[model samples]
Target: MISVESAIIGLFSFSIVLLALSFFKKDKYKELENQVENLTMIVMQENYQLKKKMKVLEEELLGNESYTVPLNERYETNGK
Candidate 1:
């Protein structure tokens, strides 16, 4: 028993509300995207620094004369 005019008006009002709600969601999504990008950049920088430190440690280990000798050799040399 609903009139066609009232039904049309109700549908139009519902569509308008849905559209407005979508606009609010869009802003929140954009803000979350920016935050994720910032976090990703920070993680990338830390990874690079860790890699650099690992490379330095590898070089130091390779250059160390003491490490060139085995543990058994160290014990034998010490026992002599």
Candidate 2:
């Protein structure tokens, strides 16, 4: 048989624990969001690096060619 004061105390403590749990859950969500943003940034950096590498490779390949330019490529290069 709980006294009135004991019941009130128990309920109050329960509510406090629930609020603490909610706060921790929100913090976890923020941590996960930060991790996702970091991963996205890493992927963007990798994509930029890959594009630069591919451009260099293309230039090297083109430089090795001694043949005359194609008609379309010549027109495009002249920007007309």
Candidate 3:
């Protein structure tokens, strides 16, 4: 048989414990958020670099292909 005053005190104590637990968890949450942000930035930078490398490779392939004369043209030039 709990009295009304005892119930109120028990509820108040439970709320205080929850508040303290939340405060402790908030710091860990912030640290995890920061780690995720850092990983995202790293991934973005790597993606940009890969795109840049692909562009350079595409340009080089196009340039190399443009320099090759046709087989007939090569034969005619060499025969002359």
Encode model 1's per-residue lDDT on 1-80: one tens digit a residue: 99999999999999999999887774667789999999999999999999999878866975754655777897898899
Q: Output the worst ten-in-a-row residue range by lDDT, candidate 3.
A: 62-71
Model 2: which ten-residue window has the lowest total lDDT?
62-71
Runs of candidate 2 with Cα error greater than 4 angstroms are 1-26, 64-80
Residue range 1-80, candidate 2, lDDT tens digits: 99999999999999999998887774667789999999999999999999999878877877865335775886687796
lDDT of 2: 0.84
The number of clashing residue pairs in each candidate reads: 0, 0, 0
For residue 15, model 1's alpha carbon misses the true position, in angstroms, by 0.8
Best by lDDT: 1
Off by over 4 Å in 3: 24-26, 64-80
Candidate order by TM-score, decreasing, is 3, 1, 2
Give the backbone clash total of model 2: 0
Enumerate residue pairs that collide in model 2: none
What digit string (tens of lDDT, one per residue) describes model 3 on residues 1-80? 99999999999999999998887774767789999999999999999999999878866866654335766886787799
Candidate 3 local lDDT, residue 67: 32
Which has the higher lDDT value, candidate number 1 or candidate number 2? 1
